[model samples]
Target: MSAPASAAAQDGVDRLTYAPMVMADLDAVFAIEQAVYPHPWTRGNFVDSLASGYSAWTLHDGDALAGYFLLMLAVDEAHLLNVAVAGARQGQGIGRYLLDKVAACARGLGAESVLLEVRPSNLRALDVYRRYGFAEIGRRKNYYPAHNGQREEAIVMRFVL
Candidate 1:
């Protein structure tokens, strides 16, 4: 385990604990995903990731689920498959904390860069990625399912290690 990371929430400062996510955490993690995203990744997606041995982790603030992230490494690059902070825990620097952890994990795996895709309308996420040194690399058309049978494009971003 690493030193606890702190995030200032509305209640006070929360000391975050990082841990490898397991099957047992799925209930809480899935709840967060359903709550935070209209087009959330299915629970099966998470299960598959774990089954495939991707890097999956959860963040907790004193037994309270705070956030989670999934990373997939391919050759010299790492891809951030999914990352989310609890709705109540957003804007408290937890996203960056998760990113920092994921980046470290990638680097440890010998990845030279990290890549991700974000919906263009996800302004908050876009800002976070940019602030964390990710740059727009390209766009993927119709990459994300949208409301009413539509599809949304994805803004691809890359962060070099």
Candidate 2:
């Protein structure tokens, strides 16, 4: 069966706002990560991202967390490190919204391109990246640690801003 209609509606098609993530958002953001990712990032990771000055954002709809993304900026590029829409809010264009916001931020920062890595097995995410004009440039072997102590390869994708 497909996801509930309400859940689909929560995918951010309506009145949603995007803003830079702050320290106060860590709790809700980490909760979403724990709910959605198999190998979720720790609180430390999020803290470090903020501390190290990564560009991060959260999508909200009347106080509900719809999604978030974390990107690192370099001289002429932005690297997307983590991105996710709430599990129940998938397939409703939330990812696209987040991507657009990231691209805009990159442009504002004078970036020429955006880069990201995704697990080869995550076809859904890969498709989303492709829809945003991200092209595979290379692969990193054993990049993602798996549950059974195994590792999975990650496909590196890039989009020219």
Candidate 3:
């Protein structure tokens, strides 16, 4: 596949592009997953998502893997299964860019809203989602793995399209 468009770092500009995730991109994607999360999804999880035809996209800054996200479209809602930015690229507006793309993709799929679950401890992500117009809709008990073999609650959020 052709490389993504080159990134332009001048004047704090961002030139990011994304492509559909493929099996060949898993090594790099998994590396980022391992680096970014304490309870990262396994390679098998990603493989399964692809096999299930989940919508997965990998963001690139030129040739560098900057980030990626996955979505599963339901009848009228798009569930955001995963979204991540490389540690080095966090806080560079990449997350927002990815979110924008996610909304576009969801709309294209005839979704009326986007739904996701976020760890309560992920304050940074929560802030981003709130600022992007997502509202807390509910909570899920023991939704995520936590430290010391405990479980963490998930704050379910939704953004109406």
Candidate 4:
């Protein structure tokens, strides 16, 4: 079982460990990316984010990858660029755990708000963000590519810490 947020990954057995993402981890990360999203981020995207020094972090369940999140902290705001829990691990609270970690990291970086863009059609993710205290702040027209070569709108949400 996962422990309290205050507990480090090394304390006893929590089965969750996180560290700064390295280039080597991208292959697995990209695989998860492909499996989870129809409009998955390309290898170049992850590579460029790493090159630009974004806080790309990942979680592990023992030797297996559990999840990953990418965030950009700037000027009192943290942009949640991307976050994903491995498909088989979805209902296990790993997403919430990672989110809490992100919030904490943002707070440490002196951010007052956390911002993320979500596709309106992604009800599962919308539910998660809403339950986690994010509220809709705005919308982006045709922000995401959709089925049938169409586009989907994005809901912009913010969580004030």
lDDT tens digits by residue: candidate 3, 1-161: 74333332321225677799999989989999999988999999999999999999998778889999999998999999999989998876777888998999999999999999999999999998999999999999999999999999999999999
Kindly report which residue stretches of model 3 are placed more than 4 angstroms away from their true locations once superposed. 1-13
Q: Write candidate 4's Cα lDDT for 1-161 as tens digits.
A: 86664464334226778888999999989999999998999999999999999888999878788899999998999999999999988866777788898998889889999999999888999998999999999999989999999999999999999
lDDT of 3: 0.90
lDDT of 2 by residue, 8-51 (tens): 65544668888899999999999999998889999999999999
List per-candidate RMSD values in Å: 4.6, 3.4, 5.4, 4.1
Q: Which 10-residue span in candidate 2 carries the lowest summed lDDT?
A: 5-14
TM-score per model over all chains? 0.92, 0.91, 0.91, 0.91
lDDT values for all models: 0.92, 0.90, 0.90, 0.89
State how far residue 129 of model 1 sits from its true place (Å).
0.3
RMSD, candidate 1, Å: 4.6
For model 4, name the residue pairs that clash. none
TM-score-wise, the better of 2 and 4 is: 2
Clashing pairs in model 1? none
lDDT of 3 at 75: 92
The candidate 1 region of ten consecutive residues with least summed lDDT is 4-13
